[model samples]
Target: MTSPVPSVDLRLVDLLRHDLTAADFTVPGVEAVVGPTAAAALHREQDVPARRAVAAVLRAVADPAAVLTALWVLGEDVTRRQVDAALPGLGADGAVALGLVEASGQGADDAVRAAVDLRPYAAQDAVGEVTWWLASDLSELQTGRRLAADHVLGAGGASLTLAQVTMRDPRGRVLDLGTGCGIQALHAARHAGSVVATDISRRALAFAAFNAALDQPDAVTALDLREGSMLEPVTGERFDLVVSNPPFVITPRTGAAGGGASGLPDYEYRDGGRAGDDLVRDLVVGLGEVLEPGGVAQLLGNWEHRRGEPWTERVGSWLDAAGLDGWVVQREVLDPAEYAETWLRDGGSTSDRDPAVWADAYGAWLDDFASRDVEAVGFGIVTLRRPDPAAAPAGRVTLRRLEEHTGSVRQPLGAHLAAVLAAHDRLQGLDDDALAAQRLVVAPDVTEERYLTPGAADPNVVLLRQGDGLGRAVHASTSLAALTGASDGELTVGQITGAIAALFDVSATDLAAELLPAVRGLVTDGFLLLPQ
Candidate 1:
């Protein structure tokens, strides 16, 4: 039987916190006990090495950290004495009461096993580095079975990815839609005056509440936990910022191939129970209703790339429908087979373990794709901002930029995003003449590279590369290169372009017209900065 969802017993949770802190069952502490080899192996989802590593530590020393790692993290059975030692404040009985563990027998020799997956998570964002204890349903490694439909996910790669990219600017109110374990809400609480965390799963809300109270009590007090699907709970409200890592995984509809009698595996943590990417589409288009003017929403999503239709057009249409200023950075693309294998393995359906089940699910996935004429799947980070009504354009030029940047980008991109948005707004207010009069400076992170033919004097290519933000590389024309090289906050763009025009024997008007667009692109992308 599936274990009961954990209760939010503040008293017991406080005691558990005290014990956890005392035992130093933190990220660093666990790494120390498991050693680097086991730690690295565990990160790859291999537990044997971590188990052996922790076991060796326990044999040599009766350490609380080792005991906790072996019992909770490694999912190994520990004696009553070990459990008592690890959680002295919250004894074995207290742990069982909180639904964190279960005892098999009354004797000390009897083994006690963890009922949930609890681990320490540490991360650094705009707010700074923070450590928190996160609780969720145990994984296949712990339960030795496939996951339940409504599994509350812990801090996985996607969670951290969304967290790192979230804009941490201060806001009056923030919303965390589809908050799995409340990680995004926790991050939002750092900067948001008030945070509302909502989820479709009641069980997920319980975990979110528990984690919030345990990790951020002050922030949790301001958190409003509501249970509902999508935006139903906060229908009429508006927020300054909204962040979500929604159940955007595209799953097949019922009776479709691989869908089985149950249709798709309705994992509340991933699948939105909607047909073929509709969940993502609906969220993107409907977000405008809940966003206050000038508000911003950041999300991670996957969209289907249908045959003969570009991914940009499909996503761009959503942006146009919403009428919000939007930018999408496609990070990766996977074909139908690769996509099926990934999600299948993610849900613990592997060919080696169950070839027949895998085959059926695989066929269903392919059939679903065939029905939709989907050639591939595209995944990316999407940033949307509601244009401020006061500064709204007469023609309302929506920023519909769809670019691919799969390469490495600077972490904690919140500040960069804010800068880009600010720059865009500033540029919007300036006409060509006004823009030319403004002084400009090259950003510190930008570098220029020139490549020349082996024995030739004149360079054949000039590239301006950004070392931060999206890490963009732009090809620069001779005149534009000269303009950027001289941009030191000391010369107006008009004067620089005039000098370049004279040097190249070109009309100043023609040269400015040619380079103005490139200049605007550089500034918006963080390669150039408008003088303060």
Candidate 2:
């Protein structure tokens, strides 16, 4: 059976919030107790260093923040007396009543274990910096065991990824599908005029409600919480923005993990209970129905890289069916073996703990993939926008970008993506001559690099690099390079191309023909920017 979720009693939550705030249960507060070394280690899933450091601090004196972190954050057993000292306002009894912790023994000297994981979450989104507490099921680090099937997840790497890439433009109505513990909904509430968050798991909804009440007591009208799977709850409703980090993990449907008494995990939070990557595929094609004509959807998903077929073609087909402007950036590709190990460990089925079970599950994953001739699994972020017929005056498919960028990217990519979309619309509305008449300047973050051979006067290759956004670099032809270098917002594209054509002894018409498309691309990618 799954564990209980935290209670949302307003009076008790207010008291708990008061105690937590008084004790300084925050990111920096915990860092102060555990030190930077231990704090960073904990971020990497190494809790030993943090546990030792917290233990050392607890031994020195009575610090409520340290005690709370030890009990809730670290999942360590803390004495009732210590908890009392830490939370003088709420006391240990109030914590137990709120389902935050459970008594592990009988007396005041007895130890208590955290029934739930409560921690501070801080981030920068469209509205600005925000700091609040989030409550969810305990992790493997605290429980020292595998996750339950119906486990409610807290903020993790994938959650942070979707949050970073989500566009922050103020929207009229936003829908956060499969919102686990309401993390994305909180961010959406900051900029959205109205926010609706939905999920399939009742336990997850409970945690979301508790978190919302704790973090956003005054946003009752702005935030709406609902329960149902995918888009079922909000049928026929259209949203301006839809963001989901859904249950997209591909789990084996038979043998080791299919059912009861098999000693295998069937995680409800990650697995949508559908076979392979079909759940993600359905989301890609189905999201269009719930989005407004000009609405946008942001999702993170996994798609199979089948044998003898390109991954882009596989995922692009979904977009074709979607009939929307789409951009899919494949960040990482893992073979069957690598994918098996990565997920198996995530469920706490580690080799050190149960090698036989791990091996069986690994074999099952291989067998399942082999049944379909799957070569690899591609994980990526998907950004899709339903076509606004008005924006494209002429009938045109505006965007269908499918590429990979595995390197570093600037955080809070919302603004950068919004800029790219604006550029796309602007360029789409312009003809070759119209575009040529306009002046463009290089963005401040762009730099040009020229590579040369030893003892050579002229460079062999020219490259224009973008420092942020997708961190893209493009190879520039000599003509294009010259045109870009002269783009100081003083001269129009026609003037620059004419100058380059005259210097190179080429026809200006042919030169503009060759460079117009390239220049438009540069502007779309933010290497060249339209002057404000």
Candidate 3:
């Protein structure tokens, strides 16, 4: 498989970066060239509006970003002169030298075609806000064809999800596994002192290196790029943090290479070249070998929902083998047919495009699921932490949380996840009595809603809803509601629970024991906050 990934030349990359900066090729810059509606339409994979908008801009003036948008983002070919004007610093020559664009013909009036998809990227994370450019292989959207077997991905949905959910605390060493295009590695570099990014595809590593050079010119040396599958490149090494958006996509193994109709190409960016769900399970189980004690690893995965079996048991079995504090949040569930359609469409092998191939591939997906009695597939974020040996509960995995929440949640969830981890550790350090003695306050984003019969004084139902961080809606018992409502940071939990117990004619100690666990949950869920 011959894949043409971008080459890395620091000098040329620097010149290109300079040209991009001067041309105002940025998130805001792109939006300015194309109106908001057009910019927003691209998210839906509809580029007609954007093409028309940029064409309108070009008709008025040779706006650098507008020209760049048409050629680079919309996948349109342009005259060499337009490329020169748009990137005055690097000009057409430098872009061609960098393998970003190529000359269409030998004539002086020859056109220039984008060899890679280069676009401005912007995101606000725990480290801070960043605006950088990412270069990856042209997608089916640009090529107007099916993706190549070794497609290097840009910042897609999974990449962004893993980035937003990653814990961003400063660390000594970090590893980005299967780092296609190095987007996660770049985000990690903002906080990690050093990053070792590895991928099974050298083309991916090439793109990763190029992206690193373009975005972090001074810190280009900070990223050590390696090429190997999963943890093989970092064997016998321990990292304080490990992040991955691995090639966990479950694909039918039709051949030795997992390719060429039910012949789905083994997309290096997604397919792990393994059997169903086993790749993800093995990756989770093997992570303990590479993580330092108390180190954290966050990644996204898909698990099978088999018939006559619960999803929790399926995923929990992996956590038990990992021997780490594991938390799995199943975010989405798709039926077998839907799953087939989603992945087929993702690889640009849709029914309309290729009905025969789509039918073959779609039937293969259904048969593949039926083999394992898989009724559906659940996708979500997975966070694992290796327990420190020195801790009291050293010998076993003390934390195991498997929950499902398929709803809107806050983005840039790094801080929230970090805070919740801290809260869990703090709670673990305290006993029931210690927890009761602590003062707690309701989070400002939290609200209470009560439903009652017509003109009834007492409510029929009480709901304590979190406005952020999974947006949990807890069914608060009358006592629990009273406890949170009176939690104004003045009264200790012991005092408040005692008062409520007396008013309800219940034993104080029993009430404290009952509410203490609930209190701990609230603290972890961001419904209640510990005093600063």
Which lDDT values do the candidates have, in the order given?
A: 0.88, 0.88, 0.89
Candidate 1's displacement at residue 11, Å, is 2.6
RMSD of each: 1.8, 1.8, 1.8
TM-score to native of every candidate shown: 0.96, 0.96, 0.96
Question: Can you write out model 3's per-residue Cα lDDT over 1-532, one digit (the tens) per residue?
Answer: 3446778878888889998999999999999998899989998898999999998999999899998999889889888888888888787888888899888765646899989999999987766788999999987888887788888999998898889889999999999999999999999998999999999888899999999999988788999999898899999999999999998888878632247534668788999877889999999999999999999999999999999999999999999999899999999999999988788888877624657777788888888888899999999999999998776365557789999999998888888888888888778778888888889999998999999999999999999998877788999889999999999999999999999999999999998888998999999888888888
For all candidates, what are the clash counts? 2, 0, 0
lDDT of 2 by residue, 1-532 (tens): 5688888788888888888899999999999999999999988999999989988988898888899899889988899998888888778888888899999766789998899999998876545678899999998888777788889999998998888889998899999999999999988888889999999988898898888888988774578888898899999999999999999988888978544355466787898988899999999999999988889999999999999999999999999998889999999999999998899888877724777777788888999899889999999999999988788644345899999888888877878888899998888778998999889998889888999999999899999999989899999999999988888999999999999999999999999989999998999999998877
Mark the 10 consecutive residues where model 3 has the least summed lDDT: 254-263
Clash pairs (backbone) in predicted model 3: none
Off by over 4 Å in 3: 1-3, 105-108, 255-258
Error of 1 at 91 (Å): 2.6
